[model samples]
Structure formats: C-alpha cells, structure tokens
Target: MAETVQAATLRADVAIIGAGPAGLFAAFECGMLRLGTVLIDALDETGGQCAALYPEKPIYDIPAHPAIEAGALVAALEQQIAPFAVPRLLGRRIERLQGSRGAFSLGTDHGDSIHARAVIIAAGAGAFGPNRPPLPGLAAYEQTGSVQYYVRRKEAFHGKRLVIAGGGDSAIDWALELREIALHITLIHRRAKFRAAPERLAQLEAASGPGGPIELVVPYQLHALHGDGGTLASVEVATLEGDRRRIEADHLLAFFGLSTDLGPVSQWGLQSALHHIQVAPSTCETSLPGVFAIGDVATYPGKLKLILQGFSEGAMAAHAIHPIVHPHTALHFEYSTSKGAPGSRDAPGSLAGAGHAPRPAAA
Candidate 1:
C-alpha cells in the first residue's frame, strides 16, 4: 500500500511571495498597517538573488550607504523586520493559487497550503537555476557534494584543493575571496581576459604573483573528470592548442551564471510580459483583484528595475491592500515619524492590541 502525503495549511492576512529585499520590506509595511503577514520563498534563506547568487559582492547603488555587501544588506533587512515575527515558508515553491480577492489559497510543491486575504508576488525574475557545464559525469560528482555552483558558505572550502572554472565575476570574486581559506586555488578560464570588474581582475592578477595561493590556467577548457565512486580526485583540461593537462583537486566550483524561468507563475491568469507580471502603476495590483506584483517580477510603464523602485512599489501595494483586508474600517495614513515605530506604545494600532475583525456598523 502506498502512503498518502498530507498538505500542511496556514492562514494570514497577507501572503508575500519572494523573501528578497522587496518582500522583506513589504512584510514590514504590512505589519505597520496592522495586517497579519507571512512570507514565502523558493530559496531556503531570505535575500533572494542577493543572498544566493552573490552574497559577498558589494552593491554601490543602495541609497545612504556608499557600499554594502549583499549578505550584510540582507542581514540588516532581517533585523529591521524582527518585530513583525513574520512566518516564512522557505525551500518550497508555490505551485498553484485558488480563490480570489478577500480570500485566496496557495498550494506549494511540498504539499503545504496558505490561506490569505491578499497575495503579493515579489518573486524576482521568478525562479533561478544555475547553468551547468557540459562535462560528463558532472552530475555524479555533484551527488557527492564535491562540486559547487554557488558559495553558500566560504568556510566549507577551507583547506581543500579547489579548481574553479569560468571567467565571470562570480568565478573571479570567489577565486580571490577563497584564497585565504582554501589549501590551494587554481582558476581555469577559456580566455586570458576576464569579464569581472577591473579592480577585481587586477586583484586576481596581483594575487597570482609568485608564492600566492592562486594559480591561473588560461585559454583552456575542462576536458574530463578523474574520479571514482562520485568522489573527484582531479580534473583534465585541454588548451586551444590541443595540449591536455591534469590538476589534482578535491573540489570544483563552476560559475556559469543562472538561467531564470517563470515556473508555476506562468500558469497563473495574471497578464505577463517578458516573464514579468503586468501591474498597475497606482496600486501595483495584478489582474487578480487582491493579488499584487512588485520588484523585478513586476512590469509597469516607466518601471525601473532598481531596488529603490521596488521598495516604492511594495509600499504602494501595502496601502492598496489595506481596504480589502479591512473593508469596514477607514485607514488613516500617517508618516512613520508621526506614528512612531511599530509595536511602540505611541504607534497607532500597535501589534499588541491591533485586531483584524471588521468594525461594527454605527448604530
């Protein structure tokens, strides 16, 4: 007899998809409006691409701070929303959505479901997957955990012989960053030139000087993998001149960038363009009455794909959603400075006393 899997269920006033900066900020905004909120993300952790693709990379365009590491920015956002105590459903993909407007049901691939009055699609570029190399038996080695596409934790590479492939920013960045921890690092690129920032390329070049922890093998492509039982012992590469060389390595890090797809979101009835959800500029609302789209996943006239722009969109969607979630009450919008921080005694409708019930009709 086969066992049946049971779907776990949850309830919230607002369900914000994609736990990126935009989604995190949206949760905070909704909390300020006294709305019960929950966040869902495909990745196991928050911060979306900033956390998954390039945690250590520096972002210079964020307002206020001249420069901030991607991981640090995510950490700060996490701290800012600590008071909200928002529930997060991580490592699960939302496969289907049912119901409309005042009530909606979300079904996840893991058999989990959420019931919410309003839904926010903040999913940046939908779902992203790593681009794998063409090397045979790569999957077998990946099964052993000896091959990595992204650096979730730098400590994992400590004292291990690593052979990194690619000439992109991720490849060069990790190569330079991992030098201090890894036993020895060899960077293999198909061309002598790299596509990374000029400063980073210079740093890699300087570090490759005599006695440095890194070695550069340029104008070469990975030819084969030498290993047994899914454990890699070394890798074989061939030069453009047809010369082959082998290097001993315990691990391989390949950075070929990502391939993004709309995934289950494409199946939804919302209007879309170039894989982005079409939204109204005034409300950020999608075709569905109570469903909103923001961030990179949202498309609008004069839409700027900037983080600040996404932040504005989140605020707009939150304000627009207030009436639907609380039809009987008239929301009074006030600046944060006047209302004070959420949860404060001075803050209007603090979480301690805020209620979601509709106000009774006047006698």
Candidate 2:
C-alpha cells in the first residue's frame, strides 16, 4: 500500500503567479487596494530573470533613476512592497489551476494549494532553464558540481581556474566580472563575434589585452572533457578548421541563455499566442474573467516589453480587480500623497517617509 499524502491549503483574495518585478509591483498595488495577495513562483527567490540571469548587469531605461543594477532594482522593488508583507511560495511550480473568476484554486507540484478570488499571471517567459552546450559527458560533470549554469556567487570562484562558455551577455559579463576574483579566466566562444553589448565587448578587449588576467579562446567549441571521479579536470577545444587544443581548468561556467516554456500555465486553457497569454490592453485581463496577465508574459498589439510598462499594467490590473474583490465598495483614486498607506497616521498626507505634499484635486 502506498502512503497517502495530505496537501497544504491556503486562501487569499488574490493569487499572483510569478515573483518577477511585475508580480512584485502587483502585490504593492493589490496591497494599496487592500487586497490580500499570495505570490507564487517556481524559482527559489524573487526578481525573476533580472535576479536570476543578470543580477550584476546595469539597466538604464527604468524611469526616475539614471542607472541601476538589475539586482538593485529588484531589491528596491522588494523594499517598496515590504509594507504589504505579501506571502511568497517559492521553489514550487503551479501544476494545476481549477475553478473560475471570484473563486479559483491553484495546486502546486509540492501538493500545496491556494484558493483565491482572482489570479494574475506575471510569469515572465514562463518557466526557464539553462541552455546547455553540446559537451559530451556534461551531465556527468554536472553531477560532480564542476559544471554550473548560473553564477550564484563570484567569491566562490576566487583563486580558482575557470573556463566560461558562450558569447552572450551572461557569459561575457561573468567572464569580465569573475576575472577579478578567479585565479585565471578563459572565455570560450564558438564565434569571434559576441552578442554582448558594445561597451562590454570593448571592456573585455581592453582587459584581455597585454598582461590581463583574462584570455580569449574564440572561434572554438568544446570538443571533449577529461576528468576522474566525476569532477572535471580540464576541457578540450577545437576550432572550425579542426585545430584542437586543451585548456586546463577546474570548473566550467556555461551561460548559453535560457530555454523557456509556458509550463503548466499552458494547460489552463487560456487564449495564448507563441507561448504568451493574450490579454486586454486596458484591464490586463485575460480571456477568462477574474484572471489577468501582465509583464512579458502578457501580449497584445503595440505592447512594449519593458519593466516600466509592466509596472503600469500591474496598477491597471489592480484597479480593474478592485470591483470584483470588493463588490460593495467604490474605488476612489488618490495619489500616494493624499491617501498614505495604512498604519501611517503619524505621517498623515504622505507615504511614510515620502515628503511630497498632496497635490490639489484640480491639479
């Protein structure tokens, strides 16, 4: 006889899927609207791709700030929503969604369930995995912990020999960033031309010049791996012309970008196109009532995939959801200055520490 497993259940006014920037901001919006929200994400942490893929990279287009690192933006967003204290269910993938608007149930693979009045799909590009290179025995090496798909910490590679594979922003960025800590860094790419930013490429060139700690092994691909006890000892490389060489290294970092899929969200029967959910531009509502999509996962004509745009969409979805969640109450739009967040009576007419005065209603 098999053991019977009991599922954990939770309830909230709104169940938000995905813990990316859009979803985080949605929690803040929902909180301001006095809606209880529970956020679910497949990743172990928030920030989605920004935190997972390029935490150290710089972002310029985010409004109000001249420049900010990708990770810093995520931190700021997290701090902004700290007052909400939104419940986060991480490291669990939503396996099934049942019921309809005003009453929905979400079940995760971990046997945890959530019952919510509304659902928001803010999953950016859905569930994503690393794109591994076609290196023989790569899986075996991965089992030994010598192969890494993502750089979780730079200091971990300190004083160690590393061979980074790929030509994209992640590969180039890590190669450049890790050069300072690693004993020696070798950037391996199949093509001489890189998909990294022009400025990054220039920096890499300058750093790799003369007696720099970095070496460029371009126009080459991984040919073989030599190791024992499941741990990688070194890697073999070959050029398109068939010339081969061996590069001794203790570890390999492959950042070939991500392989994304809609995952269980695709089985929800929502109208979708090319893996993205189709949503109304005005309300960010999906084909199903009481369900909304925002951020990179939501698509429509003239939709610009930007963080700022996703922030606006989250606010719109929150306002549209207000009527459904609180049927008896009419929503009155007020600036943060006019109606501060809850529990800020001491700082009336302001959002806590935000010193801006309330703007006149006519203005």
Candidate 3:
C-alpha cells in the first residue's frame, strides 16, 4: 500500500525524519555526499529532543571535548547542517511513508507527497506518549487541550496559567523549569514520590517557601475537568485521603514519557526488528538497501540513546550511504566528513557533555 502514497512535500536523494542531532547530522552527511536531502520534523525547530524538552540540562559522556548544554549544542549542530542547505519541513507531521529507497513517497499534513529513494527515521522517543500512568480525566484533557504530550516550546504557555501531570523527573523538572514563565502550576501526581535526580529535586524544594512552590498536589488525582467551550478553566482534584479541591489554570502540561509509532511507514515492508527498521549494528543501513536509521530511534547491541550517539550514527549512516550512492568511488575514512565514526573521538564538536554540566565548553 506504500508503493505510491501522495500528499505535498519535496523530492530528494535522502529524507530524514526528526531534526534531532541524528537528523541534523544526516543533513550534514548528505551535503558532504552532494546528495539532495530533505529533513522533516514535528517541531518547528531542529535538535529534536535535545533542543526541545531539556534545553537546560547538561549532557556528558560524548567523548573528548568536555561539556555543553543542549541549547548551545543544538545551535552549533544546526549551523553544521546549514551548509547543506537541505530543504526543511518543520511544524508538520508525516502522516505516512510509502515506497522504498530512491522511489519513496511521503504523506504530509501540508498536502505534499514527496518522492525520494531513501529515508532515515530519526523520530527519537518523543513522537508518542508513555505506557504507564492512567490519569483521571486525561483522555478528555488530551483531546480538549488540558493535557499535552510535548514540552519543547515554552513560549506558547508563557504568562498563562497551567497545570502539570506526573510526579516523575519530567513532571517536576518541567514544572520547576517553566515556573518562571508560567502563571501557575498545580502538580498533580498519584503519589508524593518523584523520580527526578536528587539534586534537581533539591533545587525544586529550595524554591518552595510560602505557598509551597506552585502547590504540589500530592496523593491527588484529577477527578474531572470543568471548562467552557473545551477551554480548561479549572481542574477538579480528589486526594486519596478524601481531600478535594479545584485548581484554576489556563493549560496542562503532561511530561509522561516519549515514544514513536512509526505508523503506516513501518508497513512499507522495510527490514525491521520488532517493527523497527533494522540496520547494521554499527552502520544504520536497513536490510532494504539504501534505507538507514539514526539518532535516538535507531538501536544496536550497545547503542546509547544520546545526542552524542545520534551524531555518530548520522555521520556513520552518511558514510555508509556515500559508497552506495557513488558505487565506483572508494571511501576514505580519514578524509570523509565523518568525524566520530563509532570508535573515533575526532568529530571536532563533541556533544559528550551537551547536557548542562558544572562547566561549559568553548564551541
């Protein structure tokens, strides 16, 4: 069924879904290979999860070059992809994917069916929601706008009243993180226990003084929602100990978890492991010829799901495809655009410490 799906997009030699570190690096690789490439992402900006969810967090373990924050690193990687001048599709969703390498079609909500030979799915885990936590009134709120899955864009809720669901790292983290801009936060969780790093929790605790830091509603569940015209005006809460209250807010932020469905695109009959398109352990080439996977979405025996790892995967996938696209050409590992080729730490810029650390590295 994926042989000839259509909508509105662009033709390209390579198409990368999700503009995280993997997708951005893939664009860089495509530029180096002189292949026309197009990068697509659900969010308006690049850098994927790193750019969106935890821009404030610092990342380490990228190998070599000390540390950097997610925001700065995303900006730098984005610059690297600029030379490619790859056509970009942002603030849009890929409804479906069809066909195969060099002959693929994309179905986008923008009403474009793009044609390409090869595709790389780098959607990370942010495309979908997590499996656990059956919250009260969550389904209605999700459809009505009281519950949100992604937190990449903070400006949207600036100066607006909001309520957040979840007591884990993301919940508390985002709650504490966005408190500066958001009007109000009623953190509703099933229990009092939080799953964030102890240090982060300490910071959150330090901020709570008089009203108790944005009203942490412990042992509480959203009983129901009362809003006018689908707009969330107040959230009804019921505690396990029989306490009840109503929280007035403008919006809801839910930092449950992240996932991806791969949707009908996976049905295009590409080689896959457990439905995920399979690629060589080291390189991201899928069993179906030119197709590849990179970034947080791609998996290998010991693959680490981090921007550092994603950057390496993008570079490797590009290098691997260079030979195939230019069949008669010999690949020179030393001179190729690939810097961090799995075992090497020469990738000029290391996202190793891209997460927020005590010290920031000079880009």
The candidate that wins on TM-score is: 2
Alpha-carbon local distance difference test for all models: 0.86, 0.83, 0.67
Best by lDDT: 1
Q: Which ten residues in a row have the lowest lDDT in candidate 1?
A: 354-363
What does candidate 1 score on TM? 0.82
Q: 38-68, model 3: which lDDT tens digit per residue?
A: 7777777777777766675556655664777
TM-score, model 3 to reference? 0.70
Instruction: Flag regions of model 3 displaced more than 4 Å.
Output: 1-11, 41-75, 89-117, 126-162, 180-184, 208-214, 226-233, 240-242, 248-251, 271-275, 335-363
- C-alpha TM-score for every candidate: 0.82, 0.85, 0.70
Better of 1 and 3 by TM-score: 1
* lDDT minimum window of 10 residues, candidate 3: 353-362
**Comparing 1 and 3 by lDDT, which wins?**
1
Candidate 3, residue 182: lDDT: 83
